[model samples]
Target: MNIKQYLDSTYLKTAFQTGISETENEIVVKNAIKEAIDEGFKLIMIRSEYVALAREMILQANSNLNVGTVIDFPEGKSSLETKVKEANEAIANGADDLDFVCNYEAFKNGDTELVKQEVLVATQIGLANNKTVKWIIEVAALSDKEIIQLSSLIKNIVISNFKEEDYASVFVKSSTGFYKTDDNSPNGVTIPAIIMMLENASPLPVKAAGGVKSYEEAIEMIRLGVKRIGTSSAKAIANGGNIPNQY
Candidate 1:
């Protein structure tokens, strides 16, 4: 089934989050990049600070692995200008995919205009640069209705402003793999959430991120029609092993 091609090998932890020194955390990121190269995964998703390093490694290895970085990661409350600047910097640093954390907070607060503007501007920047773009909706923070609404919103915006051929390049990704919940519930993609996204964001593909651990689960997501599965345990999943307690 070549599940490796459907995986976006991800490592987005910061030094502070890992309670390690910057040098130590970088070592982790470097190993993840090298592992992605060796495993022939579809892409490597990392923090913005490591985009340049990832680019250098992938280029030196002559690997076809695409480099993806998050914009306003984990939090979607950043201003439109800030998101644009971050995305541009990632592109200049050689990121092939820009996974933007959409301003769902604003959308929830009845500020649809701001959300729409950011989606338009960010998608425009990415499409203009010939880069693939994905909007992270942080499904853990939203209800089913919100998921459908937001997914439809992104789909509608892309359909309205962009051409038909470009729709596939803009994805409605599920999570940032960093959201926290009150009951310590699953803070990433879930079956119900992914179903909602796929049902509502059709023609605009879906990328399931966060909480996808085992090869079986990844296969299930793919079976449910997600174009990509983002996970930290890419190697384990690719090899039919499981990494317990990994996000």
Candidate 2:
């Protein structure tokens, strides 16, 4: 099924959180890069601080993999200027795809302008750099109505501000994988949420992230029109196994 091509083999963790030293974290990152190269995944998504290192490793291996990073990460509350600067640095570090955490909290609060501005600025930066950009809406934290609305918002903004051909460079993605409900419910892409996004954000493409732990789920997500699958278990999925949940 060329499943590896659909995967964005990921490793995004701070040394503090993982309780590993910075050098240990890099070792882990390097292992992921090597695994990606050996397994032929389409991309390796890591934090921005490691973009250059990942890029160099991929280049050294003579692999055709893309380097990706997250911006504003698990929280979408960063100011527009900060997101832009982060994106710029990632680009300079050789990131080919950027998954940006959208300001859904603001949108839910009726501050649509803030959401739009944040998206517009990030999109502009990615497009100007000739890179692919994905807007992570953090679906597990939203209602069905909000999913449709936010997906539509991203589509509308990109369509109005960018050229038609550039539409392919933009994607409305499903989650940050870090969101949790008050009751500690699982957070990430669900079938219904992705269906809403696909229906509302037509022609803009979608990336399903989080909770995709097996080949079966990944295949189903692709069947439902997802262009990318973000998961730490890419290798496991490729081998028909499951790994612990990662965001």
Which prediction has the highest lDDT against the true structure? 1
Clashes of each: 0, 0
How far is 74's C-alpha from truth in model 2 (Å)? 1.1
- Tens-digit per-residue lDDT, 1-247, candidate 1: 8999999999999999999999999999999999999999999999999999999999899999999999998898888989999998999999999999999999888898999999999999999999999999999999899999999999999999999999989999999888889999999989999999999999999999998989999999999999999999999999998877686
Q: Native-vs-model 1 lDDT? A: 0.94
lDDT (C-alpha, whole model) for all candidates: 0.94, 0.90
Which stretch of 10 consecutive residues in model 2 shows the poorest summed lDDT?
238-247
Instruction: Tell me, by TM-score, which candidate is best.
Output: 1
Q: Residue 61 in candidate 2 has what lDDT?
A: 87
Runs of candidate 2 exceeding 4 Å displacement: none
